[model samples]
Target: MDAAPMDATALLLADSRFPGGGHAHSGGLEEAAARGLVTDEPSLASFLLGRLRTAGALAAAFAAAATGGGDLGALDAEFDARTPSPAQRAASRAQGGGVARAARRAWPSARLDALLAAQPRPHHPVIVGLLVRDPRDAARVVAYLAVTGPASAAVRLLGLDPLGVNAVLARLAGEVDAVAADAARHARTAPEDLPAPGSPALDLLAEAHDRHHREEVRLFAS
Candidate 1:
């Protein structure tokens, strides 16, 4: 049987040209590339897979929870606790703030207003969850973005073939769907009970990147 239609909002948010400031950030790929960690298609696939299982899963769960609906502030606080790196947190909020701004103009609602009011710069996944509403769609959007942003950055940073990078992402499609499905299953879980799958390497990379970004010129924000 054919799959259900994709949610329009999820598609829009997942689009690279969504004007959400996602282009400026590399989702830790910049740091990994600078360290010569992700150089080609095979290595890129490994990096994306590791990221999808850890950071991607965490974001997906939070996004799913947000879509399921609960106290926004509590959710934000829980998300904050899950994020160990200050730089990573900053990137998330910065992206979240950007999405929130666009969402205010494109899809205004009391829920959005309240989210911004409580925390002007909430976590990126949280904002996505609020906007998408569908637990599966919200989880899918964040889970997809988790690797795609870094994959795009890989193209620019490594000068690898775009086709090769796209193929790598295609190969990871099953893993992404698995993560989104797992996240959707816990959409209605309590805020504190949400999963916190940590990525120590990514966190370290984010911190290193922040330091390097301050010391010299860098292409992506984080």
Candidate 2:
């Protein structure tokens, strides 16, 4: 199979400025930072790795499942089941809704429209998976986002060196490919059977952030 189309679509959607509103959310990095869980470059790297393995793995799998055109409703429920925190669930749907709206305008496909009609707001990884044709590429997009959001937020919140923060991402490139491949392998599996790696600490942080920052100003949405 030719890889050019898949590569291009993945690159386009992976861009932080993809009009998908991905830049508005910090992927829970802000909350972690406030709690001192991620205060420096080294801490940020650790947090990203943990996320890439847990939430990141789940996102990649779900995106790959979406690529398979499975029952999205079941997929959505499976995704929610994996996410234990209400705050995190809301964040995922909000980001999903943003990505879905942007993708519909950009791709303009019947399948995308049907996905929206089926659910007014789908999971972010699910919508991303539906937009990209290659299951591996879909996984790649979500895995990349898993780190990029927090990495970007770290730069702003901690005033960390941009060069150093990006180095953390570049260092994880191999793992990103590995995660994407692992996720794509299950593209044909039942939605309930997909990987459900969860990060309990991240979920707790998200709930804490939402509970405390309801009226306070924050740099990131989640």
**CA RMSD per model (angstroms):** 1.1, 1.8
Q: Candidate 2's residue-wise lDDT over 129-192, tens digit each? A: 9888689999989999999988999999999999999999999988888899899897999987
Clashes of 1: 0
Q: Candidate 1 lDDT, tens digit per residue, 165-195?
A: 9999999998999999899987889999999
* Candidate with maximal lDDT: 1
Report the CA-based lDDT of candidate 2 relative to the real structure. 0.88
lDDT of each: 0.93, 0.88
